[model samples]
Target: MTDDQRPGEFELIERYFAPLAGPGGLDLRDDAGLLRPGRGYEVVVTADALVAGVHFFPDDPPAAIGWKALAVNLSDLAAKGAKPDGFVLTIALPRDWTEAWLKDFAAGLGTLAGQAGCPLIGGDTVSTAGPLTLSVTAFGTVPAGRMVRRAGARPGDVVLVSGTIGDGALGLAVHGPDRPGWVAALDDEQRRFLADRYLHPQPRIALAEALQRHASAAMDVSDGLVGDLAKLLKASGIGAEIDLDSVPLSAPARAALMADPALAELAWTGGDDYEILCTASERDYSALIAAAAERGVPLAPIGRIVPEADAVRYSGKGGGQGFARGSFSHF
Candidate 1:
């Protein structure tokens, strides 16, 4: 359809998005969103962009696509020990866009948005000749002086990761067109478990408060654990030695690994796991673990910060591992 027949941007937004708007969004009629700063609290903001066939499969479910666009940013907020507040969204649709697609996407997004207590604030809409693109800039609040950062870790701090790693990575493998022969070892439930993990990221929002009380330095393992941990350590001007055997794994990932032990590399190095990777002082480590366990999130200790500056050593079959391009880089 030509531009003349297409619905106005405002009409589309009001129909599919305005209902998701948070406070100060002015029902999408205002020039800007206003989020008054809470007394004694600070705001944390993070953004992530996803493009068709880049961040996600072009044929992926529209709802999953919508959920992921925001989840990734929320993961960032979680790493910073922030709680959901509100967010702005930007979407660039290709020529073949439709109202039905937007409807389903909004439903998918609203499902998680409501669950997470994050709301849409305001944003821009436009047409693009390129692939479908979506971006979310999310805002969250943490008590003043309590927001977590990636530079506070010191020597002797223990490295801990929440939940299992590699599930999302294995999920990606199952979703790929060239499905690995090891896929045969996984049952239908295992396949679904891995695939769903890839489609929906479980941001450790519940563990945010615990992290604030215990974590010295933290960041979500959006890339690979090893690479992201390296980044965190570099920020703190420290190093670490991790036991690869201790890296957490889900049932499906373990099954796949058992079928093909070599998949350990992909499981350990492939990105998409949104779990929180953090460092905590050994003294506060128990509190952190207890907090995570209370929230029903598994906390695994994989390594410890060392005095050697900027060194990352791992012991396991994955020893001497090196990423060709160093984790998932859109660039």
Candidate 2:
């Protein structure tokens, strides 16, 4: 079969990208996705890109590529306490890509956009001699003057997280050949859990709005907590003391770390959780939990922000207190 004739993009898009009526009317194929924010709402925008062999592995599934591209961009809007509206896409395809691959990729993007109430309005496609790349721009709206920012944290604000951490980092450990047999023997369910965490990170969009009502400052956990929190502290001009024992972990994560002590370090430094991390005054703690409950997101208190100390500290139950290469640094 010729390249263009097999499993065309239109057919894949119809199955995955066609619009439906949810909280909003989704129209993935339309010239523009319609959005009507409530009265007194303001729009916010963020964009991100994932390049093959850099941001993602070469063998990663096409559907996953689509999901991660949109999810990462949405997390940025979520960090700003905005309601997702729609998005635009730009995809660079390798010259040898088959029509089936493009179809699956578009379908995957459509699936996520539908679930997140963000329609794919418009996009550009180009053939490239290098690796494939996907870029997405997401738009969201927040009530006038209610959007949250990283700079709002205060010295006494409590540090909190929406869900567990470290699953994605541990997943990367299993991806390598040097991993132990126990890790290599992980069952399908365990493998799938980590795989999904790495591929389809759940952007804390609804949680961002909930946080706006009570959180003094907020941001999504894109980079590991240590690195991301540093950014938060820098924005707020404060320092913090995190209880290492308080960091949450999934069942698989705990197991993987037990097999390899070094894995714990990876958990703290590894990124890609996509959960919401926030800070709020003690007075706002109960209110913040209440707001999160109303949105059906569980909020967990992980630590507290202290005065502007010269260093960040991590306190453990039996492991003592100090930063253990606490964050991921590009340099």
Candidate 3:
């Protein structure tokens, strides 16, 4: 078979991507997917791109690569308190693409797509000279004027986060070779937990209802917490005081942190955590936590939104201090 005809584009789509289609997908025959927000609703859309060796290692499990691609976008929708509508996928397949890899990738993508009720809509496939690259444009629906924004945080609003922080960065450390000397402290179980975190991140879709009801402002922590928090504060025209001690940590993260206090910087500022950093009124705090709990998501209050006029701006207290690292920067 010629290079261009290697499992021809249409053949590939029909074999792999079409099975993931939802009602709006039109069975992969149409050029565009269809979705309606219905009365009293709005559409929430988010797009994320992943490149080999940049976002993830090329040798990583095909299934994991597929899962991470969709999960990251879902994290954004969840932060906005939107229900998963569906997604369109565009992929640039490199010359090395194999049928087996694509099959496993589809399986992984379908698992989460099914779990979150986000199906594959319509998209394109093309050959690329560069690395294996993938992009997904996922959409969601929310009640009119109910999608949360980072600009809504007000003074005295409680700053909260869902799930434990720092696992992704820590997991990345032990994920591959050239391990930091500090990694010596992690046991086999600890290593797996961290590695799993890096490989498969869980998007908090279930917490959308709670956030819609209580959040004043919210955003996903894709770029380290402190940096993402800084962005949110700037957007909201506010500052915050985060209690370093209160930042939630998984047992594996805690153990890793104890091994080398320096890891705290990464845990605080490293990227890929994908947790929701949000704010709500003090009066709504208890209810929000309870609501999140009902969904099996752990919601923790780490700080409070402060006026932008505060002299301290964004400061951390207890145990670890300083925002010197800011967050992972692409530049």
Candidate 4:
């Protein structure tokens, strides 16, 4: 390419990068992004990345990708009951990414940060020889001795989940291949609901903070409920009994699972739900819900922690109850 035809990185950033970087907050021309936390605040840091085919689909929208990339990291902080301070983003762009695509991506990222009261601090951008990837590191702070940990669950603590579950997994089912049973019965709108869930999962940051204020144990439901809850129980050195009928599936999910009994296991094993599963004393449950409601968030009671004889158990319909064994696992 001729000298004039070559795209300068700075010029490319200004033309496409600055706008999406969020409204007039950061100076894209600076050597580094700026981050300023208020006095007396201690920062907590967390990071996560999504590979195009691995974490998300190739057809996923730029805005949703940007929103979710930040949301997932924020969810971690929320589980710790932290206040978001800011975030940094690193993007591995495909060689052919148009200026418009970058602009949209930046805009999407900016919008999420602005609304969440977290600023985009700084990050790197590089050309990727392979599929697109986004990495975001989020920062936050909380009062001393206020952060919740997974290891705090006491036996007899009531287990709770924020919002419904299984929607995202159902969303994947609708978009991907039809499994032997449940996926086939979904109508177009039902399929769309599931697909949207898979594409867009809201982070439970605010809810996490609320839970930390009152919960003995707290975790985000990134993996299936049974799986993630089991992790929390293991961390707390406790065991739990989750009523299968009380697993809190959405209407679609309930209907779908009802259609294929085998898929009930899939619902428990599927990952990427992004809700919050927590445990609190029965005395604290109302308070937890009240705090969440003050922030306009929803919380629900689903199960309870028991002695550690078995890791987890499930009691389904028709007087059925048994061990869960495990949930969505990489191995």
Error of 1 at 229 (Å): 0.9
- Candidate 4 clashes: the total is 3
Computed on alpha carbons, the lDDT of every model, listed in order, comes to: 0.87, 0.76, 0.87, 0.75
Query: What tens digits encode model 4's per-residue C-alpha lDDT throughout 1-331?
Result: 1135435677766665565555546876677876565666567778998898888876667877877898888888888788887788888877677666666676667677777778776677777889998999998887766778888998888888877787887778776644445666877777777777777777776685677579888878887777788788778887887776776777777778777766676676687788888888988988998999898877777778888633665565621533243442211
lDDT of 2 by residue, 1-331 (tens): 2266554444544553444223454555565556567789988888888899988886778888888889998888887888888887777777677766766776677787888888776665666799998888888999899888989988788998887888877676566435656585566788778768988788887787677778899888877888888888888887777777888888888777766666776677688888888998999988888888788877888888887642466677523533355542211
Residues 226-273 of candidate 3: C-alpha lDDT, one tens digit per residue: 889888887898777777778899999999988987788889888889
Clashes of 2: 0
Looking at model 2, residue 160 earns an lDDT score of 88
Tens digit of per-residue lDDT, candidate 1, span 158-197: 9999999988889998987889799999999999999999
Please give the lDDT score for candidate 2.
0.76
**Residue 309, candidate 2: alpha-carbon lDDT:** 41
RMSD (Å) of each candidate, 1 decimal? 3.0, 3.7, 2.9, 3.5
Superposition TM-score, candidate 1 onto the true structure: 0.95
**Model 4 per-residue lDDT at 322:** 35
lDDT for 301 in candidate 3 is 93
- Candidate 4 residues lying further than 4 Å off, grouped into runs, are 1-8, 16-24, 177-184, 318-331
TM-score, per-candidate, Cα-based: 0.95, 0.86, 0.94, 0.87
Comparing candidate 1 with candidate 2, which one achieves the higher TM-score?
A: 1
